[model samples]
Target: MRFGMALPGPNVAAVDCLPLDVLPLILEHLTDRRDLHTCAQLSKAFHNAATPLLYRTLDVRVTMYTGMQRAIVLHPSTTILQRPEYAKYVRHVRENGAVGFHRPDLMDDCRKALKMCVNLEGFTWSDDSAEGTDEGDFMRYLDILQTLPLRELVIQTFYGLSDSVWAKLQDFSGLTKVSIWCMEGKPRILQGWSEKLGASLTHLELGVSSLSRAPHPLYFLSHLPRLRALRLKGAPSAAILEILTFLPQLETLDTEYFGAALTRYDDVPAANLRHLTVRTSSVHIQGFQQLWPWIRRLTPRPSLESFTLNAFSTQGEALVPRSFILDMAATHKDTLKRFKADSTQMTLKDIECMCTVFPNLESLSCTTMWSPESAPYEEAVQKANKLRELRLNLHDWRPTHVRLAGLNNANIEVAVRNMMLREGAALRLVGIGSIVYRGQWIYKKAEDGSDKVEFEITSNVIKDVWD
Candidate 1:
């Protein structure tokens, strides 16, 4: 009887005594996957607890083939391929099946892995071929997708899918967000198919290759009652306006180009629109003036929240006037929150005028081709009090003898610094200089009421400066 008596170590009993539910909570705190893998190997209980968390969010991107190879090499001991318990954690992959000449066996294994992931919520299919054909394999993968309900689906194809596969997508009733980047001719067939699934779609992105022609698939989106976000690139402005008229509840509208013809259709207004982005070299100050007035004339004017203009170019030798920007901001001041302009030859005075108009703006970013004249820095700072994010490009300022006549390097730096400080707690990011000053960049951040500024100058800039 005495020989049968045994004693336990001090912490041994306590370690085994902890509840099984607490294991997951502890493993979640681990930051690195290697640390989690080590924890999993400690015991079978630990393995079961950590395996799901580790296997969740599987990335099968073409770029991550090395990681896939490693996973395959360790498949025998890890048994992740055969284990059903790990399937629930698998939510996404860059590709669904195999392709090309390498690793032919990986195709079957990857499909098997995908099948086990019946609870997947996100899926992205990116084809590497510039002109390669994968229609059959793509169709097979789409068939498999029908089994899993997904919230997000992203498809990037160098060429378009077959019409049969596009028709089969009607069954994807649970899809809420979809992004399609199809080859030039392929998007034409999508019109009817998109209309079929329009009721359930909330976010839709279409990137086409043709900008001069009408988007053939435009009619398919005419009934997207639930659609809130719509992004169209490389499509004619007429087609874009046609789509905008259909989306009654639309919240976001982003277009790559605004054709000169858009001015003719100013009579059609998107009343429910809130966020708008126009990345067009065609838009000038005059075009914007004509466009904004029509937008303001909507019966129930849209509460435009965020506006972005990119790649804007002006005719002849013209600079964006300070008063013009100020007037535009004042017209939409009540509902605006974020305002951005890039690639415009504007001056510091023009930016300050914008700040005065949209004093409640939370995010402000502008690329000016002309630096400020050494006037009063406080005036610019006072106008940008509510700015949260600020981006100023001194390189955007043209170094004309006329503009930089009286300004020196010290004066330019002081003016830029003052503009940033005015953003206060709202400033989270800042970028300075151009290609010539490539490495000479400054960034600042504020945390817990403390401000930190960092200056990083590249070797190229330092060498050129000293040379």
Candidate 2:
């Protein structure tokens, strides 16, 4: 007798059944590499949707090595080399010169794989090896990279670049962003880059162990008419802003915040500057004293959107003077949205004043000492109804009288949650007492069209929010 064949089950394509175009758009939002890896195994469609996202940024940098280990693990570039198609998905590659030391053949693999990355747009090269470790001709990799469609270049090395490598970099005309940090002697790498890549270079960062005594480290940078963001280390704040007089299109500046006041400020022009970060130490008192006047001289009122003053002191705690806050509020109150001052002290009254004065303040971070039950804390949050994020460093705030009673994590969470419920409907993040919680307000439209809001708060590790 003839046996009947088993019937086919219902066809179900799972979530991967979405159109090829729509599926990629959804998969691209997956930030966790583990999730993307799992999705890549679901089906050919899912693999196609997630492969590019997974391989988009190839980080083959060797972070660590131990003598106890056997042979070094093969670099990811080896896989890209074997599977030529995966090379096409690598749009950015971060490599440390140490990768070659881990295995002599790794550099060859990286060079071959990089060539296959015809669409590569960004490249980050770092060398963390000991001083005498052979650099193994950076020119080899640069030669292949120059042929690609690279647009962003970042180099942080302990040793200086050879003249040939620097010249090869000058030939890279399509670069839109360049960051070079050399821990060696004074680096004069920006000599002629302005004439070559200035039209496309919008973001530039330069750091060096030593700086020349010239009026400005790189005078040629003034020719970069389209420069929009400039970050400099080992450069005086006064000298950094002097270039701003020439960079009319510059919108953001990050630099060491110490220097003498500008010798000639009367001719200073109004800049489009929006975000400024001064990462420095309080040891430079004279420089700090001159900083306020320099900021005030920016001409005209309020255009800065974010200001971060990260000042640390080796002698004792540094404090941001209320006068400085008052000056900032007077000039930038209307536009300042994010303000961060770390390691420096801000009192409860200062925090309260910031909230009350800066109507548009969205993110505020500072080290402050305030009793959770104090009126200043209450007033600060009440006025900070519009603040979207609040981060406070209160490690120094644990007073002998209230440390056992009120400084515990449980109590702090309860007190902060109450503050959020009472005010700060717009608040989404609260960080204090070495703890971070992320919350969101869920709103419903009322019958009268007024909004009714509900909220949810959950504890989160620091990296989850502010990595």
Candidate 3:
């Protein structure tokens, strides 16, 4: 049924007079599944538009009924051969638990759904319940997925990436993003995959086991074309830096630290990079130092806008070097907008220095880092004049050192915003567009001696969780 030229049925003709935009506006408010179903049946036009919304995400729940899962997929698989209309509506498919292969009818249902849903973009089988249930039926999943056009695919419980499995991946020529957990296949599987799909891949996440014992840890990343994002947790800093050298086009990078050897590498500034987040397994001085190479490699005046360094010290006392902020300012002073360094013991003077380093910073969150010192209160306030969203959770046990005491109590924040406004800062409209002043000092210290703090909760654009 070509909807573009099909004759409008009586059911659809009713809403045809509504403005083209009205349908979407009306549907946007109809978040309930039952309402969408009712709309789909009320009019053919609604049916055509609403059907996709109704079936956009199909999560196949493996059940024990054993009464034909295919019937559950298409509702009417027999009519599916005659009517291939349901295929276009589906975009994402989620599979969980035992999709029993013992039933041929169920297998046929899976086959039919995959075959018809040609426009499918994502397919995932990441059910924790599907563990130890690979009962030699891995190929059946590959067979089903090979027939669809997939952009993102996740495999949680798999026996291995055998030759057959690799061949199945070859079928999804458009596959750009993948996450494999139960990796039973060859160690060389990912390298081969990167070669085939690296050119088009934009996002890649690896959740494999035994990464430290692997022969070539960076083999998969070597062949990949410079993509938009890469996430490989628990990988050594050396291997991560080496792979990053190959991907200069990356915009977002998320990696972890696990006591990897940090060696200096030739700098290839990632000019396009915008966001960088690093998480450490355990806080070590070397872990903090390992971050230098990533920032140092950034091109002078880099495009970085957001940086999050979450280093958890074992003894609850991690320290961020002053040079880290200097390096950031050198590379992304003008472009840097958001900065978060967790559990680091930096003084208020350090934060004040950061405000100067990142002049354009709109958000700053370093709760655990800025502690024990509020000596630079006046200077810090002046430097942080431009910040719109701030989360400073430092050691403020006494009223003398209360969190945001001076600014939170008196109308000092309002005075600062007023000053900023007077200095040619545009008035920000809340919930309407860009930065708008909703309220300053969202939270307040409840005057509890147990190191506890309080904050105001507003359902608005900016939120500063202080303690």
Candidate 4:
């Protein structure tokens, strides 16, 4: 009826004003970005209230450089460096380079960004380009990064960094998570990097393209007392063992290569480790045997939660046996949740053996040699009542036509019925011919009414029938 007034109430003027507590409730519905942005433009009060939510997260992807640059220009008065809450709000910054921002520009931008993020917690940078020779640029970048309030830092680059980078990294007193990707050379960088990181580091990831013949690089990791999770690529076995000794609190260990030698964990203490994964181009039977002693010796035995063994062989056969995996499953049956093995030569029998040992397993997947007869598929299915998922594959199958000696309708019918009866129950899904195989297909007769059967067989069925 009137501006800012109520039509009927004890006191119209007083009733027009709602309690301040009610404003927050009303504002709750406007919390979305689009709605908040619209509300901010409506009034100064709304703008002041919404600014914090709008400016809390500052994402600067390599391609989003223009957006960040524009924000800097628009909010020149908003000094991120001066705000104590700046670190709390700026949780992550991803610098994946497609912006053509080279080392010089990246270093400059990093310096400015770090200074403002006093409470900065995590930083990630990626420079896939293969450039930069001197360590000076990297050293400067690390130095600036160390001064920031960083708890996590990830560096993905094509350049190989020297040991000096670790020395510069020591400045980050609060750093807890680190991921480094070196495109070239073995991670000889770990030789000095581990020592500088000391006992304070909690999570470490190193990706290297090569592994050196020498063992000194791993010795540096022996001092990390608080280390919990470790991931390495192309690291030697000796170094891995050395690193394991120091990580008494370690819970997760992932390695890209099984290494030249099998891991020997006899002397190492039982750690809090629960997850172990190893991916390698090849694995010797002797190596798995060598690892057995350590595997059986964990004192405060970790309930192995996840295990992955990836072996690649040029010989067209996976050398590792099902018994080896079964031993692992039996050793940690109570805690094992997921198990996966991929190789060209392993058989379904091996997988079935593994399944029996890990009765409580939730996920089981493998790509190996599949011989259905040898696997006892029926028995495995019965025993694996707890299994939630299963993935299996046959070693090989190629199309070939067969001409029956007793070519008659009765003979064809008997053969087809027998094949379907033997395999239909076991296979809920089958892949037969290339494209048609992906989708279910029924056998069809030719226009002349001749019996011309064509169908693709899945790797699983191939294993079963062959076995």
Candidate 5:
């Protein structure tokens, strides 16, 4: 009970005698910041253990609801200036430019605080305010950040960045990860910034963030040879595959697929891509017709482990063609572990193909037109022995409602129980008709020295970590 003096009863909390080095390691498991903050006030040892965890990452974003508040809330940037000792503990800072744009005192405090954060490794500056940002105000913070050991930078501006801002970014050659999201500008390649940061850049995300006229992603992404993850929005679907040819080391890609015809990049070679996600919207089936061909082109890339398709539209059906699933099974059946096409429709046959073909699938999510009369989902349940999670958007009810009109909570529970009781079932989570269920496999020793397993399933409104 050497370190048990902080708690109410020292004799009862004997485990506090854990070595000083082990105390912080144990505190790392606590996810809630409020709990860490409370622990920091308990004892000096707890303060020493929790203070670094508290200041390690400072996020100062003004929430939508904050605009309605009358009182002025003190910004965290001012706290760092008041207590300079905590500044060295800061490793990452994400600030909304709107948080201090109108308040000069807070902006000055942030500028002073940035200089003290010598160990800061990452900085994210975003302004979602409708008003434009002054070049002078933005540069002051950037100049201070340039002196820090920053390796990751994210700039998301609703008002497009000016040429001067782009020019200043060229000096950040040491950065390894950069994400720029411009909601109002015509997306173009920052060739100068790409060339300047290419050697060290391992992750890059650029987005024009609209439905049409997305520039080809290859123009901006081709220069970074060391990239491991790249996310590009509003890019043509046809040219996405071409990027793998130029950057052999790239592994993860998240891009907007505009359903453009595959006129080029037909000879894309085998790539070591591990994850692929494409988002698109179309008003007709022809859009998906073009989508399948683009997917089929990935047949050469057998190393793919995860594929996600996010489809959006005002009208018309979103269906993942059977041929697309077959093409996926043909090349990536064994390696693919998580397949999420939640926005699209998948028939029972399509679900069967996914379950049976990809024996290693750990998570599967899709939209299904489920009816009480339709055949039971036994084919998928029996074959998906390795499946850990399944999420379905049952199209039997109106999409605007919270739950399916046809299926009640009782019906969902029965459906979930049936699936969990299947032989050799590894399924642990299921979401159907916008309702989620968590499954627990209860095991006990049988009278004959064998194992007996039982299923306990419950509706869980709160999502699990993996969900």
Candidate 6:
């Protein structure tokens, strides 16, 4: 052994003899933090190898509270931070909580811990939206993000960023993926943040955020040639399609909450977009007759591959126009691999269109109120040779259940799952799903473990997440 250690009897390799560098390389592959934490306590050699990997992604929400964050947790007196050494290994810092930072002493300790993260590349802060004018408040904590090799910044709200803070952000470079969600859209924010942060960004997501004056913030941001991925939400539908035309290089887009309106516009030019997702969150938008009518306006793109249209109304009774499904399925038929839609209901014609139009589809989902005899889904199931994943949204069974006619009152809901696997024999898996009729439409995993999802909807609650 290199460290003057003798191994027991026959086997000669000592644990210490393993190159310290090689151990860190091996430890990187150990993803379970619990296992890594246990390994870190083994010896100084293992500790040194595992500690860096442990602090690699500093999620403040968990890091502030987790017992595993030994280096940052306070002592019995709750007045001291134990190890400053752990901070340097942090590369991603996500701060979604403000637990121990109330006292100046504790806040300093937290900042001191963060100051050592010179290698931090990613940072997210959700509490920056507070309106308190306290100097060196949460913004001071945010300034710590500017120092490191910051690459991704996902800030929740910018409620009180002054001009100076905004100016600092403009000069702060090296950002690539920036997602500003739930922003208050104060006057100052609508004016400059996009233009300030737009230059260095490649993947930008602005959801439920507002912009200043006439020429929309997105319209102004379209000039930035570097943008490749975009997600726009809480904007008028009238302006969104036009904005897409402006960004010809965009490869991916996810948008929703388009304020319903019938603003007449010319044909939208097709870009090299590959993945597109359009969603209508609130059922309040009455004009959301269908997702395809809005999508059909766009000129066809040969590069388009994935399309998802989630049209959710309050009543769970919104319709997804057949023309929209057929047209989209036809336009992206060649390259389309994944297609998901949540309409009021779907029929055999819709399923046939989807199965036949998309031969290369690897994944397909629909919020269809399925019946055993409604459509011969078997029709196109054979043609969809590459089909691997299929998710169906059927009516929940309880008081009155739809049954497969011949199968002894067999819930057609369950029968549909078998039908998919039997018909699309090439399918890798068929996931059976149903929207909750009552409390939050949650998708619960089937306890029986036949790769099924069984949900018992209760209450009149509602959920916002996509099915």
In TM-score terms, candidate 6 sits at 0.71
Give the Cα-based TM-score of candidate 3 against the true structure.
0.68
The 10 consecutive residues of candidate 2 with the worst lDDT sum are 1-10
Candidate 4 similarity to native, TM-score: 0.60
Question: What is the TM-score (0 to 1) of candidate 2?
Answer: 0.86
Which of the numbered candidates is closest to the native, going by highest lDDT?
A: 5
Superior by TM-score: candidate 3 or candidate 4: 3
lDDT of 3 by residue, 296-350 (tens): 5643446888988777766555766788778778878889888877555566667
- Tens digit of per-residue lDDT, candidate 2, span 274-386: 98887777654444666666666653456889988776666666777888788878878889899898667788788888888898989988877645534345457677767
How would you encode candidate 6's per-residue C-alpha lDDT over 228-281 as one tens digit per residue? Answer: 898776666776666666677788877774544676556565457788887775
State TM-scores per candidate.
0.70, 0.86, 0.68, 0.60, 0.86, 0.71
Candidate order by lDDT, highest to lowest? Answer: 5, 2, 3, 6, 1, 4
- The residue pairs in collision within model 1 are 191-220, 369-396, 369-397, 369-398, 370-397, 388-426
- Stretches > 4 Å off in candidate 5: 1-8, 11-13, 19-30, 42-46, 61-73, 185-188, 209-217, 373-375, 398-406, 409-412, 441-455, 461-467
Tens digit of per-residue lDDT, candidate 5, span 1-467: 22323466563255346567987897877888887887787766678888999999988745445566433434677789889999999999987776565465677777788889999999988887556456777788788888889999988888667777777877777799988887775454665678787789999888774224544446656678899998877666666777777788888888777766545666674457888888888877666677777765654757888889888766755778777787788888889999998778888778988898898999998888765623566556678988989887766544434334444456557767778777788888887664588988688888998999966677745422122
Clashes of 6: 1
Q: Scored by CA lDDT, what does every candidate get?
A: 0.60, 0.72, 0.60, 0.54, 0.75, 0.60
The 10-residue segment of model 4 with minimum total lDDT is 430-439
Q: What number of backbone clashes does candidate 2 have, counting pairs of residues 3 or more apart or in separate chains?
A: 0
What does the lDDT come to for candidate 5?
0.75
**Candidate 6 residue pairs in clash (backbone atoms < 3 Å):** 439-458
